[model samples]
Target: MQKTRPILAWETLLDIARTDAPAPLRERVEHALRRAIDDGHLVPGSALPPSRTLAENLGVSRWVITEAYGQLVAEGVLDARAGSVTRVAAPTLSERMPPPHPPSDHPAPTATPVDARFDLRPGLPDLRATPRARWGSAVKAALSSIADRDLAAAHPGGYAPARQAVSDYLGRSRHVATTADRVVITHGASDGMSILARELRRQGHRAILVEDPSWPRLRDIAQTHGLRTIPIPVDDDGIDVEALAAASVRTGARVALLTPAHQFPVGAALSPARREQVIAWAHAVDGLIIEDDYDAEFRYDRRPIAALQRLAPDRVALIGSLSKSVSPALGLGWMVLPHGLNPEHSPAMPSLIDQAALAHFLVRGDLERHLRAARSRFRRRRAALLDALRAELPDASISGIAAGMHLLLELPAGADAAELARRGRDHGLALTPLRRYEDVSRRPEALVLGYGNLDDTLVSAATAALATLLRARSETPVASVRSERTLTG
Candidate 1:
């Protein structure tokens, strides 16, 4: 007896293909299909539509659909036979291993929300302000400028024009004196760090120095590459250079990863003196400094601090990305390496098409124009957020607003930030506690408020709701304890 094929709905498949994803259309479609199968949205026996039908429904070409299906089939995630249905393969076909699960005693924590009215989580940019039209124009121009052969693959280092464009942008904007040969195009700052960590490990480095209360992912990334991390505390003037030097010498940690331009979450620019001291420390230990220059462009006050690489380009690997300046959806970033580090040793480079488009975006001044407009809008949003917080929560202390998309809000003593964040969730408001960023040690209760993606209305509403919650909680809290350490915001 013949069995019937389980038809997959085109709409269902399209739902997973996010429009904001930086991947190309074909890649996005393929990724959605793989995700669907992995998540059981499409079972092993489920059959995808023919290429022509899916293309017609998606408004893409038959070739695109065919390519996506072909790639999946090659990857063993799907199975296709001549004159038959293309069905999701059995789990056995996919050799990919599931990610290692955390121990039962220590569960992994997720910050994503199911259905929230206001999401004030950190590390996201203003998606509404993304320059869609300008980016499309840049991509079109890039396509016109590239030869057919260029579509095959880019050089391991990067596409030449894009590298040159990135180098020029760094020199012009960040005051980093670098040539194209020193620039390595990467997927993003994370990928560049992973590469650097692996290289450090290969070079017999045992440990890396990172900031305490930093993005948890940084430590995870370092550990994933078989390197131990030594968390150095940060203060208002940025990383405690004296402690960093001490930690480096004591632990023999030769690699230090820092966000000196505008420190993540805390938003403290490294003081001029501290910058010099840090460089001298790097020289003293014969170490490497990985500077993450994310979000250095949108400084509302005065000119943004120059890249630390400007001072000691020979000892710093400067990483920056359009993820903050342009849009995170466009996962394009670059690294300017010191003279000694091998530029040809990148783990993976971005696609030629993306690199070319970013090159055009930079060369045509589209990035500069977009930054100017985005800065104006973000400045207004930041002001609105600060105003709302001040008016609604008079007793609440706020800091870390000098730059970046997030700020730190301190509740009165004896208030539980986690409980407050939970109360916020009840009101359909998503929030994160500053405690989440502390990997090695515990800090005082504080909330990290991200204002970049929130409009004035949402920010006001969310902050007001939080204020009410905090007022109720503060009224009943009587227990108090003294804290010995304070993380500078």
Candidate 2:
């Protein structure tokens, strides 16, 4: 009797080939085959189907299969004799090493549940709404128009055209008074912050002031670059300029980072008097202010506030990115440095192609058009969430709804925002407690509800679920409520 060969499933390879991935046919086939082997779906000595057979199954030409198999054989992932069936290669020394395991006392980690029906986490836009066709066209146009020398190397600041485009857009839209010479393109706001932090440290700055409940990533970046962070309190009028000035004097810090247009997590724009005070403080201390102009494009109630940089361009280093107005996946941002500061030796810059594409996108006015549409969509979503929250939790304090993508929801006293958030996750709702953004110990009594990425259909349901959690907490015994530090919202 003849020995029977094991049959491997071809459906996985077929599915991969049929997907819309941009890789070439041969590369895709090689990737699929390599994955199968690494996953142990095709064990050592397992026979692979003939090239002709797999080609027919995957609806690709035989050459693609042959090329992929030859490459795998060269990589030692497979073995093939002159006329014999190709088989998965035996495990090499590195591959034979035992898989890493957690400590005996610790349990193995499991993947986080991501099937949440509603995701209200802040700092994300509707990724599904990305204008793929327009971006592709922009990229194509950029590729065709860019000179050969421009591709050879990128300027440390940025391509001239990209810088000019960004400068023009900021001047017109955000009222940032800057020229292309002052613009330095960065990977994103985080990258810009990192660069600024390093520069501040180099300028003999030992400490920097930040908003108490501001975005934590920027503070972390400053700390990483050897600057001690001094937390300054923020109120309805935005960062307490008095506290900032006192801290700067006490710490001898000459740099302060702020989110003035729309404060993070709390959504307070800097009051006009406070803005002037901040600029005066910068001048009095001869300090620099790093303005984080994030998510200021989608203001709903009225026209967007002019950028704080406009007031004192000489003292403020304005950083803005496409993360909110567009998708963060693009990894594009810009910094308008004060006259004396230069980012020639700053950290990594964005890709040349991406910068060119953005220039084209801006020149064609696609960015403004996109922002207009995004504002309309976000307005509707924000209104829906506000209406739902108002109707369900009338006693709860809601603020920061005047602008930005997220609003602060302060749960009534005795209700645990953290506990409510945990319960929310179990019911397919995502919640972020306000304490997550604070460096100091604070009560977890507030949640930041981000409606930018939430779907229209799920707004009502998400709010209802949150209300149920809050109601349940309220019904619990007073003895169950634990004392915690005070939180600012």
Pick the TM-score winner.
2
What does candidate 2's lDDT look like per residue over 334-353, in tens digits?
Answer: 99999988744454577788
Please list the residue runs of candidate 2 whose C-alpha ends up more than 4 Å from where it truly belongs after superposition. Answer: 1-104, 107-114, 441-444, 474-489
Candidates in order have lDDT scores of 0.80, 0.83
- Taking all chains together, the TM-score of candidate 2 against the true structure is 0.79
Which ranges of candidate 1 are over 4 A from the true structure?
Answer: 1-111, 343-347, 476-489
| lDDT, model 2 | 0.83
Writing each residue's lDDT as its tens digit, candidate 1 over 156-207 gives 6789999999999888888987999999898888777777878778888889
Worst 10 residues of 1 by lDDT: 478-487
Q: List the residue pairs that clash in candidate 1.
A: none
